[model samples]
Target: MGLITEARTEKLMQNFSAIDFRMSIEDFSVRVLNTLTGVIPEFNKGRVMIKSEDKIYRCAAWKGFSDDIRNFQISEDEDPISADDTPKIYRNIYNIYRKALHGSMEDIMIKSGLPEVKVSVVVGIFFEGKIVGKVFLESAMDIDISKYDLYLLKFVSKVSSLFIGMKFFQERERRYHKDIIMAMVKALEARDTYTVGHSERVALYSVHIAKELGLDIKDVDKIYWGSIVHDIGKLSIPEHILMKPSKLSPVEYELVKNHPVAGEAMIKDFPWLDRIRPIVRNHHERWDGKGYPDGLKGEQIPFEVRIVTIADAFDAMTSDRVYRKSYSLEHALSEIIRLSGKQFDPEIAKVAVDVLNRVFPVIRNS
Candidate 1:
């Protein structure tokens, strides 16, 4: 009997068509693997392995095996998929498994409750003529696959390659955008020597705080980007005012306070940055309605902006300035705890201090 019938082949194609490729690469891989395995019964076990930059194939998605097998990898030299573009069948390759896994195949099968593998098919996924990944299927011993089954596997590989390639392209494009933004940050920092590395530190602190607050990856990512450019408006301020070693006059202080509003204006035209506009503009706003530009207070402030607010304040307190020395981590954290309800959101500030203490454990309770 063949792996799939004519009617099942149509059903398989329909399942593949429903895949949403716009998800993150990790998610896309799992979606493709699940759909492929769910629509076919001839295969009892399978996995998708993606090639890393080191030229090793690592398991990205799997089925019917302990997740511990995710650590299993095949070097380029040992991976048969690396040398072949078409589906190839291997029979009883126990030595191959032993070499890669450092154990007998029977040991793994017994431990993982996987049946002994008698026949397996490997299909390579390629993009623009370069091999990128593979799909390995463990076939049931009672069933024999025909040429049509191989053709269907090849079709699935082609679709998987296209989807995976698009995800890689999107990642590259995002990195390019971030590079341009970082250049702008460097330019701003060049003028204000006192705030050198301020944006990056705030971004780091914001990420830690956002994660501690239990925000999802997408929200944490937005907070990081917003924190990176939170002070971008300072670029428009006078150079002398920014670098002044003495106390700023009231007029100079007012100009300095305009930065958040100016930063929002700087990136407002960028539709891609629309999500972070509120964060850039309102990060300075206090919890008690005493902050600059607009006095959005309490819950009126966006949750993301609230997180950045604490991070921005914490970095400023702990960093060296032209006017005063940097505060110790312990002292800075003490101030954060003290002003929680007045300057920062009470809940987020508590989480931030706890997260920062863990990050700087040497100063904990000291």
Candidate 2:
């Protein structure tokens, strides 16, 4: 009774690879449960429960159950079942109804008007030596699980655990890297009182434009991170020059213009940030070949860098500088539209003006 054939196993693996685990947890949970039910059609009812920080197992996904089941919880200290790295079978689930903690499964099922469960299987989803989730398969009639059924369940559980582990570690690594970058931005901002929030605003505006242009998630993320650290090279400039209350000398202005190349060089050695080097180096490049560094004209500039360039210019216009007051929102948007074909990519500039018009007003009022 090998229920899980080689072809079925391969199909399941292919399905797993197709899922984008970066989706919301609720969506991920439902997909996982549905994928399992699709493979084993006999298990008419099931739920996926995730372990929360409060040590309670809350149902994250469920099918063929009343809405009341959505609120069901299982305490970590309960005697209903033990979750190890294996699936446990129960000949009669009713026997565990009273064994479970009060107000958990018993009360919820009663209120939901669920029928009697004749048999059930509980599979534990484990990660890093702890049970992170539980998968329950139940039936109203006494059903026998073939050896292949158990093997397939185990395979699914292991695959779920692997994805869960990878997602958790990736999020943690992203957070760690973001923290370091923010700290650098803060230090750089502290050196110039007038530009305390320039980098963050530029990043936010760039993301808005990127999304409006319907860029994919990966490019949107690159635009954001690159914008956040776009001015990293300016950290090497003397504080006196950055905070100068008057117009900069030719030499000082030249030093200021080199920040993009300097910033690119500063982060060149970090493999994780390597992809964004062009963005940091070319955000100031012009559309008509009059800009600095490499003077990349037209499409020669990276698309992401062009996006950040518009965002940077818009924010700088709206923020007060050491030598002048900030421009009005109307003036800034008009200026962006005015220079669309000259200083900026005409297409990105058009999209950016629309996005900034809707987004910046709320930000200014807030």
lDDT of every predicted structure (CA atoms): 0.79, 0.82
> What ranges in model 1 sit over 4 Å off?
1-4, 75-80, 83-85, 92-94, 100-116, 139-143, 360-366
Alpha-carbon runs more than 4 Å astray in model 2? 1-38, 43-124, 131-147, 364-366
Could you tell me the TM-score of candidate 1? 0.88
Query: Which candidate has the top score in lDDT?
Result: 2
The whole-model C-alpha lDDT of candidate 2 against the native structure comes to 0.82
Identify the leading candidate in terms of TM-score: 1
Worst 10 residues of 2 by lDDT: 95-104
Task: Give the Cα error of residue 325 in candidate 2, in Å.
Answer: 1.0
- Roughly what TM-score does model 2 have, to 2 decimal places? 0.74
Question: What is the C-alpha lDDT profile of model 2 across 1-366, one tens digit per residue?
Answer: 324577667766777777676765567777767766667667777777888778888888887677888877767877476655578887565557565655446777766434466767888888797888887777666778866667777877887787777777887899999999999999999999988888888998999999999998889999899999999999988999999998999999999998988898889888889988888999889999888799999999989999999999999999999988999999999999998888899999988888999999766555
Model 1 agreement with the true structure over 1-366: per-residue lDDT tens digits: 334476767777777776775666567667656665665667777778888889888888877677766766667776533325577887654445665556534454455433456667788877667888888776546457667767777777878888878877787888998998999999999997878888888888889888887899999989999999899999989999998998999999999999998999999888888999999899889999999789988999999999999888888888789888989889999999999999999999989998887765432223
